[model samples]
Target chain A: MIDWIESVLHITVQMGTLYLLASLGEIYAERSGILNLGLEGMMIMGAALSFIFTLAYGHFAAIIISIAAGILMSLVLAVMAIHMRLNQVVAGLAITMLGLGLSGFLAFPDIRKNILLSLNPALPEQALMTQEAPKLPEISIPLLSNIPIIGRAFFHHNVLVYVSYIAALVMWFILFKTRIGLSLRSVGEDPATADSLGVNVFLVRYLATVISGGFAGLAGAYLFIGFHPFWQEGMTAGKGFIALALVILSTWNPLRAVLGAYLFGGIDTVQYRLQLFGLGAQSPYFLAMLPYLITIITLILISFENLRKRIGVPKSLGIPYSREQD
Target chain B: MSRKINTPFGVIRIERRAAYPRHIAVLTTLLAVLLAFLAVAIILVLIGIDFTAAFTLIVESFTKPELMLNSVKQAIPICLSALGLGIAFKMNFWNIGAEGQIYVGMIASTGVVLLHAYYGLFDEHVLLPLMFLTSFALGGLWCLLPAFLKAKMNVNEILTTLMLNYVAILLVDYLIHGPWRDPGGYGFPLSIKFPDYAKLLFLFGDTAYTGLLMAILGAAAAYLIMDHSKLGFEIKVVGQNLNVARYSGIDVSKVIMFGAFIAGGLAGIGGLSIVSGIIGRLRPRASPGYGYTAIIVAALAGLNPWLIVLASIFFGGLLTAGDVLQASMNIPKTVIQMMQAIIFLFILMGEVFKRYRIVFEGKSGGDMP
Candidate 1:
């Protein structure tokens, strides 16, 4: 039973980091009043771009390129939602569609071959679909990793997982304990007030949005290189959207995001465990529905007015702010 | 939102217009569309695709009769869903759950067919209509939950609706893989082939006129309801200014629920059209993101019912052309998605021009601020 629990926890931590990275980024964006629905797009682009670069230049270059792609995708959203003052919902959706399509198109076998050739003429022409890159090396913390099950589940993992731990902690500090955090919270809570208080609403929003994209990109890189090392069309699957929901479950708090992400990750990790438990014979697909269904329930629970107030739902979220309007 | 551009010579100032003429709106929209195409072409060129060849293939989708039929078939569901979404959008409701609504619609209609086979619940003549009604109701009901939450509790509809889409899809997957799985069909992840009575009649070869007919009627209904009725006026007024609508004694929650129901129902019928009218039976992944594509179609059409038909057809052709391009040029059909996103981005940029006028002030002289 202990062994089973350790294994589940191991997988949960591995999967949970994906959500943690994404939700942390999203928490920042939402805190600055821009709800980016394009996390899936940006993440997938990261996965796809990283896979290509991982094949050509190795993991370091792949990570950088993936981050750049994410930043580029989010920049498009920033321009649409902030500069053009378009509906943030539509802009985010468009960015997601663009991401999905672009990633799929770029990863097509022939396109992948062509891209690889462009990167290195000496490289043999091959489809990326059939290839796998070396997984990120696991870094077991010496003292912490000595602690049996918890150590194996949390401490003995790839560098990306540790980065996520640091990222979440740093983000939590930045969001709640700093002047910049105050600026972001003020902008999201009341941009007009923030603007009058001499906050550069556009610049703050632009930076927050872009930073979210960077985090999303890093999440994608971790998803591809840290978790699954293979190149599949939609390996990220609905993880990006799930991460979006995680943001709400965490109530847009980075610290809470770790708990929320791991909880969902535990749910995700239990798909096989349920099979071993014999419930899979009757309802494996139903189990697949758990995470999403729970997300809806969470949304409902969070939406209660008093609960929302306690949770600190951003007041100006999804509303575009223009200086001239006020 | 700086409306001023600092230049070496002068500062260009942008100011909002009180109102724009219809001609300006039309012109700007056309310009946006053109820019979208140009951008798509440029992207294609950069990706080493023969732009002219791809363009020719896309154009052929319109000129070729057989391909046109495919486009029309594809357009039917998109048109129906977009027309439905137009109702909700007009009231400023972001009902992105059309995708989930579409899935539930498919599930409901599929349920009717399976149940009919098991128990002979109704006569053959009533089967199609029953499928239509059940799918619409289920789809609408699926949408109503989010609307109710949004209306009553101020829940964010976007995430709830989107999350439900995955649940509905998983339900479909479960049904197909388990209870509804075709027993004699070699353990395939599909239900039994829908009976002859359950299928829509085809007009030419595999092309069904039923879908087209339904799309037209749906557009007309949406047109009349949105442009003619008191409900339509209330919805518009509510969307324009919720405070004013409340002051004028409009039942805001009721309008939201009703509009959402209509939107979901239409999207549901779109799903029904796909299973019954096009594919002839339910299967895994029946929708290739038509619910999402419908958002682009509706927005591109400016939420006008009649224009949705044209926009849907245009997108339907693009979708068909993507497949053709994939088959012939080894180009992924997702290029169409890229183009759609570009078009949407350009249209969004055009919205700025429509609402504001930019004037280049002579040189950065004194009193510019």
Candidate 2:
């Protein structure tokens, strides 16, 4: 029973990191009043780029290149939503479609051949997409790893997992405890006022969005190298959207995001363990539906006007910021 | 109102337009499409594919009669789905769940077929209409919760509708893989094939006459509601300004609910057309993002029902072209999707031109037009 509990908790933390990293960045973006609906696109692109680069170069190069790819993709959104002042919703959707299509196009066997051929020329071309990379090494902390079930579940993991823990803490601190965080929050809440106070609304929004893209990229890389380590088409499969929901559930708080992501991760992990609990007869499809269904339910629960107000939902989210209009 | 920017040699002014001529908007859209095609060609060239050969194949897809007919068949569902989305978007409701609604429609219509297959209850004459009504109702109901939440609680319809889409898809997957699995043939995840009585009547070898007629009728009905009805005016008013709508005594909630229902029902009909008319029965991965593609179609058409027909056929041809490109050149069909996205982005950018005019003035005071 103890062993079962530890493993479940272990899988939960492992899976939760995907949401944790993605949502943390989104929290920053939303805190700066930009609703980027293209996280999925960025994430998937990150995964595809990382997988290819991993095959070509090493893991470090793959991670950096993926982050660059994500930043590049988000730049499209920043230009549209922040610079061009297009409707953020439509622009985000366009970015998503672009990412989805571009990633898929780049992942094609022939396209991969030409790409890898150009990159190295000496590497094997056959079975490129199916090729695996060296997984991120797991480092267990000596004293922490020996504590209890929680120790192994929490402390013993890959470097990215630990990076997520530090990332969340640092993000939470940067968002609430610093002047930069104040400027970001103020910009999201009221860009006009923030601009009046000499905050560079455009610059802050651009950075936040790019950072969000970077985290989404890291999440995607973690999804490939840290979690599944495979290149199946459409594998990310709405996980990006789930991370979006986690942003709201966390109420734009990076600290709260930790709990929300893990909770969702627990829900996801529980689907696999349903069989172990003598509920093996339940269809895996229905179990798969839980996270999405719960997201809707969460949206409904938090949608009460009073709750939204009290929770301090960013006021200018999804609205374009224009200095000329101001 | 205008905003002026000082460049090194001149002053550039961007002035808001009260209105632009219709022809200019049309021209801009056409230019955007041309540019999108050109952009795709460039991408293909960079990847070492022969752009001219690929372009020739795509043009051939449009010229061939049978392929044209297939494009028309593809147009029907896209047309229906876009029409439904047009209604919702007009009311400023982002019901992106048409994909899910399509799945539910398939499920409901397939349920009717399963019932008939098991109990032999309904005759051939009643079967099609029965499937039609059930699918519409279920599809409408699928969107109702999000609509209700958006209306009453002010929830984000985009997220709710999107989430439901996955739920509806998973529900279909469960049904096909579990209860509705075809018991006779193989272990494949598929429902039983529809009988002759359950299948839609086709005019050509593969194309459905009913689907075309339904799309036409659906557009006509949508046109009547949008242009002639009081509800249409209410929807327009509500979308333009909620405060104005409320001040003018429009039942905002009722209008939103009604519009969402119609929108969902139309997408549901699109789903039915795909399942009953195209494929024979329900299956997993039935929709190839028809719901999402409809968003582009509706937006391209400027939410005009009549224009949606033209846009759908145009996009449907592109989809066919994508299949051809995939088969002949070993290119992924998502290349077409990339083209569509670029087109959408360009069109979105073009909206700036429609709304604002840029005038260049030289510092020397000689370049004003």
Candidate 3:
């Protein structure tokens, strides 16, 4: 029983760590009113770059390259949606397409020629499971790791997992306590209003977006180096989208984003755990669907009166800023 | 108000035009698309492929009859899906669930196909009608929940629609992998092969022109209805200004529900087109992101039904050429997909030109005229 419980908790933390990083990044972007749906693309590019660079250099270089890739992709979105003043949703969708395609092209440079391995049958496959990637060594906390199941799950993890937790806490603190956070929030709330009040809405938005890119990149790198240590084209899969959903579920709170990420992460891991417990063998697909199904239900419930009251969305969440527009 | 602005070369005056000429906007869009293509060409060159070979592969996709036919066949599903989704978009409804709608439509059509295989229920005439009806109805039902919520509860349809998409796709994946898996396929995740009578009739080489015609007809119908009908005008009004639409006594809720239903219903037909029309069997990973690409097609065409047909065909050709490039040049399929996305980005970026015009002038310079 202890083993089963410990395993579930360990997997949950691992999955949750990824979601937390991605959602933390998304929280920053959303708070500043930039919805870059290209997150999956950013994550994918980060994963591929991290994988390649890990082999070329090391984990540190991989993380940096992944972050750079994220920033670059976000800059593209900023140019189109921010500077060009195009439709945010359309621009985001396009960026996502570009990100997914380019990353896939780069990652699987010769996969098509090899007939034996499965093609990225998964839309956006990123699991280069065949190749070797050096995994980040786990760092067990001294006294904390000696504790119980909680210690193993929380304290014993790679550098990325601990950093992701710190990042989430830092995001929470910076967003809630800092003047910059207030400025960013105001811009997301009403850019025109913020601009009228002498805030450089453009600068704040750009910074927030780039910050988002960094976290997303770190998440991707962590996904490859810390968790899987191999790459696939679409391996980030729907995690990016799930993180987007988490942003909403958190109701724009970075702390709540952490909670939401872990919650969803637990839901994602539990299904596989069910399969391990021999319950999912008969209908693993049905069991596999638990997470997505839960997201739908949560979305519906969030739309209800009580939850809706709690959820505070940015006023100009998706609108591109234009000086001329009323 | 005319304003003087500083420039690197010289000071310039800026003024907002009341409106730009339609022809000018068209020219700007064309120019943007051309520039975007040039940029992709540069991208190709940087990726170690010669620009000429890439250009040749694209040209070959259109020049070859077989490739062109394949393009049209692939285009049918995207066009149909885009046209359907375009209606909701016209009302500013984010119906991103077209992917799920299309998947379920396929599943429903496959269900009908299986019926014919097992029970021998009715003739092809009746079965085909059943297939179309079931597919459309199921797809509509799938989206109705979100639409109803958006209208009544004032819920965000974007989240609901997108989440439903995952649910629908996972359900399809489940079916193909387990209960629906064909025993004779040697562990491949695919449903039983559809019977001949259940398949869509072909008007081309081993492919169905039925879907392509349906897509064109659907577009025409959408064009007529969106431009000419009262419902379309109401949708436009609601999309442009919801409060104003409500003040005009347009029964905004009904419009939302109806628009979503029709949109989902049309996407359902698109799903049926591929399953019954092209693939002729249910399989895992059957769709190559047709529903997602449908959004680009719809957006690129400015949500105009007729133009969506063109955009869909263009995208379809890119897909075919992508396959060809993969086979001949060893290029990844993603390169073509990236090209499609770049075009989408360009179209979106060009939107500013539709509403605003750019003027280049030196310091202290007056209008050209």
Candidate 4:
């Protein structure tokens, strides 16, 4: 019983950490009035790039290169929507299609092989079964980890989990408290007015997209290196879209986004637990779809007028700004 | 960039502007699409495939009569769905749930097929129409939710429709894998092969010529509706300007709902044709993402039904060519998708050029005319 409890907790922490990082990045982009529907493709691209790079180089270098690639791709979106003044939604969709096709083309041949053997040549044959995932070093504070339930949940986690929490807090602080945050909000709210105030609306939007891309890349890296430690085709599996929905459900608040991600994570974790507890064979697929069902429900609920008025979205979200038009 | 004069009422006046040459845009889009194909060709050449032989294989695949018939057989669903979407786009209603509606229609048609096979209530003649009606009803019903949400609640229909695609996909996957799995099939995740009573008749010997005929008929019907009906006028008015439509007492919501219903119903019929004519058994990945591809077809054809037929045939030929390239040239099937994306991007860019003109003026001079 104790071992089962420990394993469930471990799974929850891993899933929650991955989702929290990705949703936080989505929060930043949506708050800036840009809906990056290409998140799924971006995450997949990041995962593939990180996986290949980590196999060739080490962990740190792979993470850096993946982040750079993600930012570079996001720049294309920024150019089409901001400079060319194309429709944001369609442009985002086009980018997603391009990313998916490119990644599939690149990863098709190598995906069929056992990638782990190329990465770690020193492991024994039996170790392959047990070490399906490479263990990340956990950081347990000497005194804090010994407390009660809260201590085990919060203090005893890997470096990536800790970084996700810190990153969420930093995002909340920067979005709510800083001058740049104010400018970003203003640009999202009314780019014409923001530009009239000499706020450089285009530049702010470009920077926000690039930063969001970097965070999303890190999210993908976490999926590869921390959660499963394996690569699969089309593996990001709609998590990026869920993150986009979570941004709306959280009312574009980064802090609320963290809470929302963990809540979804908990639901997903419980569904898996239910399956493990001798449910029928088909239960897992249904269980896996729970988070997506909740997201759709949440979207419908938020579309209610009173609810939306209470937690307002940015007024001018997804509308491309044209300087000449104003 | 040019001017023409016309005498409509015996008065010749200089028409300072004419519509941008659509043929040029189409040619440019085709050129861009071919350039993307050429890039794949270069890639194949570098990978040690004989590029010329591969190109010949693709070209020959399109020229054969049987292959051309097969291409049209496949293009039917895409053309039907694109026709429906073209109507909705004309009214500025972005109904992206044609995919889900297609699945719903398939589910409905399959239900009818099972009923007829088990109960023996209707002859084959009656059964076919009943199956088509059932599919159309289910497809329209599936679309109604997103349409209702958009018209009544101002929800973004794009996201809602998109989300519904996954739900429909999962629902179909669940059914086929569980309750609907054919007992006699030895555990394969599929339904029973639909009986002859449920199948669509062939127009010629051993070909899905009836399906092709239905697609052509659908295109004609859509053309008549958009060009010669009062409802079409209302749709056009609403698309051009909503306030103007409202001011004219056109009931914009009703128009939108009507367009959506018909569009969705047509797509549902398309799905029915696929199962009844081509595949014969329900499977999880029944569509090779044809519903989404219809979006490109609709846009490429400029929302005209006749042009949509042409565009669908063109795209369907491309799909066949891509398959040939995959087998003969060692090229990935994703190259076709990449080319489609490139074409869509260039078309969108062409639209920008159509709507706005770029002017350059000297720093110290007045604006150039």
TM-score of chain B of each: 0.95, 0.96, 0.93, 0.88
Off by over 4 Å in 2: A125-131, A275-281, B202-208, B364-369
**Candidate 3 on B249-288: residue-level lDDT in tens?**
9999999898888899888888888887778888866778
Cα lDDT tens digits, model 2, B188-293, are 8888898876776644435446667777788999999999999999999999999999999999999999999999999998888888877888899899888888
Reference A-B contact fraction recovered by candidate 1: 0.78
Model 1 segments beyond 4 Å from truth?
A125-129, A275-278, B1-6, B202-206, B361-367
Q: In candidate 3 chain A, where is summed lDDT lowest over 10 consecutive residues?
A: A112-121
- Give stretches of model 3 more than 4 Å off: A111-130, A276-278, A302-311, A323-325, B1-4, B12-17, B202-208, B365-369
| Cα-lDDT of candidate 2 | 0.87
Model 4 lDDT per residue over A1-326, tens place: 66566556666767877778777877777667787776766777777667665655557776787778778778877787777777777677666666666666555552212333555665455533431334456779789877665566667877778888898889889988999888888888888899999999888889888877777777777777766676566678777777776677677888887778777677678877776775675666676666666766777788887887677667678888865433
Of 1 and 3, the candidate ranking higher by TM-score: 1
Model 3 / residue A240 / CA error / Å:
0.3
Q: Which pairs of residues collide in candidate 2?
A: none
| Cα lDDT, all candidates | 0.87, 0.87, 0.80, 0.74
- What order do you get sorting by DockQ, best first? 2, 1, 3, 4
DockQ of 1: 0.69
Best by DockQ: 2
> What lDDT tens digits, residue by residue, belong to model 2 across residues A1-326?
99999999999999999999999999999999898888988898888888788888868988998899888878888988897788887888888888888888887888877887778777774536454666788899899988889999999999899999999999999999999999999999999999999999999999999999999899989998888887766668889999998998889999999999999899889887885675754466787777777778878877877887888889898888986753
User: Candidate 1 on A1-326: residue-level lDDT in tens?
Assistant: 78887889999999999999888988999999999999998999999888888888889999999888888889999998988888988888888888888888888888787788788777654534456777889988999987877978899899889999999999999989999999999999999999999999999999999988998898899988899988787677778999998888888999999999999888878876787787756476777777777778888888777888888999999899976753
Lowest lDDT 10-mer window, candidate 4 chain A? A108-117
Error of 4 at B225 (Å): 2.1
User: DockQ of candidates 1 onward, in order?
Assistant: 0.69, 0.72, 0.48, 0.33
- TM-score of chain B, candidate 3? 0.93
Task: Put down candidate 1 lDDT per residue, B1-369, tens digits, no spaces.
Answer: 337777887888887787877777788778877888898888778778799998899899889999988898899889988998999999988989888899999998999998898787888889988999998999899889999999998878888888888988888888887888878879888887888778766444354466777788899999899889988999899889999999999999999999899999999999988888778788878998999999998988889999998899999999999989999988889888888877777777778888888888868577454
Model 2: which docking level applies? medium
